[model samples]
Target chain A: MKEIVKDIRRWQKQDKKIALARVIDLDGSGPRLPGAAMAVTEEGEVAGSVSGGCVEGAVVLEALEVIKNNERHIVSFGYSDEEAFSVGLTCGGTVHLFIEPLDW
Target chain B: MNRKPQKDISIFDRVEELLNEEESFALVTVVKGPPVGEKMIVFPDEKSGVGFEGSLGNSDLDRVVSRDARGELTAGRSGVRNYGESGEAREETVQVFVESFIQPPQLLIVGAVDFTAALVKIGKVLGYRITVCDAREIFATTQRFPLADEVIVEWPNKLIEKIGQTFGPRDAVCILTHDAKFDVPAIVSALATDVGYIGVMGSRKTHEDRINRLYEVGVDDEGMTRLRSPIGLDIGSRTPEETAISIVAEMIALRTGRSSIALSETKGPIHD
Candidate 1:
C-alpha cells in the first residue's frame, strides 16, 4: 500500500472508482505477507500487488466485479481448491484476500 | 447498500496524510459480523493512551479492538483477528482486519565511501530509510550518494548519540569507517543502543586491533558479541556491490537466525 499510495491518490483525484484487495491471511509458503495490498482503478490501472503474479489476474477480475457491484468479498486461492478456481498460487500456499471498494 | 461517496474520500485523505508524514498508525476494519465495513483509525498516544479516530459501532468493541490494534502496530504486523460480539475474547463472532502502517526500518551508514553508495542503493531496494553520515564534509555530500535518504556531515558517534534511541532490532548501523578514531567511538555508542545489526567493515588485522581498542574503551564481552567485525558473510566478495549484498544478506540472516548457507545445502523450510 505504501508503494502505491501515489497512484491511489492520483486515481482518487480523478474521482475514479477503485477496488482495493488486501491479503488478510495466508497459510504455508506464501510469497507475500498479510499486509500485501493491490488497488485497481476503473480505468484498468493497477497499483501494488497482492501476490507474486500467480493470483493477480484473478484478483483483477475480482476487483472489477467488486467495482461493478459495490460489494465486498473474501476470496481464497490455493492449490487445495476442489472447485478448480483456475487461479492458484504455484507456491502451494493458501492466501485469503478481502476485496472491497475504497469506500471507507 | 451503497456508501455515501463523500465518506470514503475523507478516510482515504486521512490515510494519505498519515502515510505521507510517516506517522505510524493502524486501520481497523470490521471484515465480518455486524457493522461490516466499519472502519477506525488507531493512533498511538502517550498521554491519553491510544487514540481512536473512528468507531466500530460499539464503544466496548472499539475500545478492545483499539487496544489490540496498538499491540499489532507495535509488532509491525497486519492480520485478521477474531472476537465475540461486543469484543469478547475466545468467541468467534466478529472478525476485524488490523492493518498496521509502520515506518520503514532505518539503515544508518557511518561512512560515505564507495561502499556507502552501493549500500544506499541496496538499502533502498530493501525498503530501508538510509542515512549516510561522515565526519568529513567533502565525502558526505548528497551528490556522492544520491540514493541515500539523508547525507549528514557529522561525527559518527555524535550522530549515533543523537538518534540512537530510535534504533531497534529492525534497524541497522553499519560502520564502514575502518579508521580507529571514528570506528571505535562509533561501535562504542552503537553498542549502547538496541540496533540489531552493527557491521564494522575491516580486515582481520584491523578487526583485532579495533577489538583491543574497543576493550580499552570499556566495551564488555556482550558488547563485543554485538559487533560483526570484518563485516559480511565469508562469501569472499571483493567488489563494493558484492560486498554490499553480502552485508545486507548477513543482516537478514542475523534477523532470521538462519545459517547463511545455500538453500540447496540446508534442509527444512526455506522461510519461517
Candidate 2:
C-alpha cells in the first residue's frame, strides 16, 4: 500500500478513477505478503504489485471489470479454484484480494 | 501542491502525507465481517489521527482492529487476524489486515575498519540504515564508505549520546574497533540502549582483555551476557567480506530467535 500511495494520489489529482487491489491473505508458499498492493487507474496506469509478476495481469483485468460495473468486493486467484479463473499463481498458493475504488 | 488542499483533511490526505514523509503508519480494514470496508489509518502522531475515512458497521469491530493495528505498527508487520462478531478474540468472523508501513531498521558500526566497510555494503542490501562512526576522521569519511547512510568522525560514546534514544529493538550496534579505547565505550553505550544486537569484533585474546577492562569499568554480569564478543557466527570467515556476512547472519539469527545452524536440520516452522 505504501508503494502505491503515490500513484493513487497522482491518478486522483488527474481525476482518473483509481481501483486499489490489495493481497489481503495467502496460503502456503505465496510470493507476496497480505499487504502487497496494486493500483490501476481508469487510464490503465498501474503501480505496485501483488505477486511475483504472476497473476497481476489477471488482477488488472478484474480491477478494470470492477470499475466498469462500479462494484466492490473480494477476488480470489489460485490453482485450487475450480472456476478456471483467467489468472492463477504458479507458486501453488492462494491469494485473496480486496479491490475497491479510491473514492474514500 | 494545488492550493495545499484544505483543512478537515481526509484519511487519504493523511495517508499521502505520511507516505511521502516516510513516516511509519498502519492501516486497518475489516475485510470480511460485519461492516466491510471500514478503514482506520493510524499514524505515529500522538495528538490526532491523520483521518478515518470509513467506519465498520459495528463499533466493536472497529475498536478491535484499531488496537491490533497499533500493535502491528510497533512490530512493523502485516497480517490477517480474526475476531468474533462481538470483537471476541479467536473468532473468524471479522478478518482484519493489520498492515504496517515502517521505516527500515538501523545499523551503527563503530570502527570504520575494512570489516565495517564491507558490513555497510551488506547491510545496505538488507535495507538497513547503516551509519559508520570512528574517532579517526580519515577513516570515517563518506568517501571511504559511500554505501553508508552516515559517517561520523567522533568518539563512540558521544555519537551514541546524540542518537541513543533512537535505538530500538530492531536496531543494532557493532563495535569493530578491537582496541579497548573505542570498544569499551561503544559496548557500554550500546548496552545502555534497547538495540537488539551488540556485536564486538576481536580475536579470542582481544576479547579476553576487553572483558577484563569492561569488568573494571563496572559492567556487571548481566550486562556482559548480552555482548556477542568475537562477533559473528562460527563461520570461519577469513576475509573482511566473508566476516561481514557472518556478522549479518548472526544479527538475522538473533532477530528471528533462530539457532545459527543449518536450517535443513531444524524441525519446527521455518519462519515462526
Candidate 3:
C-alpha cells in the first residue's frame, strides 16, 4: 500500500474506479508477506503486486470483478487447494487476499 | 449498488494524507459479515482517548477493533482477525483486516566518507531512512551524500546520544570513521543503545588496537561481542559500491541470524 499510494492517488484524481487487493495472510514459503498489496483500475491498469507473478493475473481478474460489483471479499490461492482453484502458487505456499473497491 | 458521482472526499483521502506525512497508523476494514467494506482509521492522538476516526458499523466493535489494531500497529504486522458481532470474543461472526502502516526503519552512518555515498544509495533501496553524521561540516554536507535522508554535521557520539533511544532491533548504526577519536566514542555510545547492528570498519591491525582502547573504556566481553569489527562479509569486495553491498548484506544476515553462506550449501528453511 505504501509503495503504490502515489499511483492510487493519481488514478483517484482521474476519477478512475479502482480495486485494492491486499495479502491478508500467508502460509509456508511465500514470495511476499501479509501486507503485500496491488491496486487495479477499471481500465485494466495495474500498480503494485501481491505475489511473485504467479497469482497476479488472477488477482487482476478478481479486482475487476470487485470494481464491477463493489464487493469486499477474500480470495485464496495455493497448491494446497489445487482442487478448488486452477491457479496456484508455484512455491507451494498459500496466500489469502482481500479484494475491495476503493470507494471507501 | 449504483455508481454515484464523486463529490466528497472519502477516508482514503485521509489515508493518503497520513501516509504522505510519514505518520504511523492502521486501517481496520470489515471484510466479512454484515456491513462489509466499513473502515476505521486508528492512530495515536493527544486529545482523543484511542485516536479513532470513522466506524466499523457499531461503537462496541469499533472499540474492540481499535484496541487490537493498536497492538498490530506497534508490532508492524497486518492480518485478518476474527470476532463476534458487536465485539464478542467467543464467536467468529465478523472478520476484519488490520493493515498497519509503520514508519521505515532508520540507518545511521557515522562517517561521511566515500563509502557513505554508496551506502546511502543501497540503504534507500532497502527502504531505510538513512542519516549520515560526521564532525566535519564540509564532509557531512548534503552535496556529498545526496541520497541520504539527513546529513548531520555533529560529533558521532553527540549525534548518537540525541537519537540513540529511538534505535531498536530493526535499526542499525555503522561506525565507518576509522579514526579512534571518532569511532571509539561512537562505538561506545552505540553499544549503550538497543540498536541491532553495530559494524565498525577497519583492518585486522586496527581492530586489535581498537580492542585495547575499547577495553580501557570499559567495554566488557559482552559489549565486544556486539561489535562487528572489520565490518562487512568476506565477499572480496574492493570497490566502495561492492563493499556497501557486503555491509548491507551482513546487516540483513545478522538480523535474520543467517550464516551468510550460499543457500545451496544450507539445508534448512530459506525464510522464517
Please, what are the lDDT tens digits per residue for candidate 1 over residues B1-272? 11223354577787888888889999998888887788888876635644777788888898899889989998888999998889999987899999999888999999889999998999999989999999999999999998888999999999999999999999999999889999999999999999999999999999999999999999999999888988999898999999999999999999989999999998877657
> Model 2, residue B221: displacement in angstroms?
3.7
For candidate 1, the per-residue lDDT at B55 reads 82
Query: For model 3, how does the per-residue alpha-carbon lDDT over B168-198 read when each residue is reduced to its tens digit?
Result: 9999999998999999999999999999999
Winning candidate number (DockQ): 3
For TM-score, the strongest prediction is 3
lDDT of 1 by residue, A8-92 (tens): 8788889999999999999887889988999998777899999889999889989999999998878999996576767788888
Clash pairs (backbone) in predicted model 2: none
Which 10 consecutive residues of model 1 chain A have the lowest summed lDDT?
A: A80-89
lDDT of 3 at B159: 89
- Least accurate 10 contiguous residues by lDDT in model 2 chain A: A80-89
Give all candidate RMSDs, comma-separated.
3.3, 4.7, 3.8
Candidate 1 chain B has its poorest 10 consecutive residues by lDDT at B1-10
Candidate 2 stretches with Cα past 4 Å from truth are A3-18, A27-31, A40-61, A77-94, A102-104, B1-13, B33-38, B44-65, B81-95, B234-241, B264-268
Model 2 has an lDDT value of 0.82
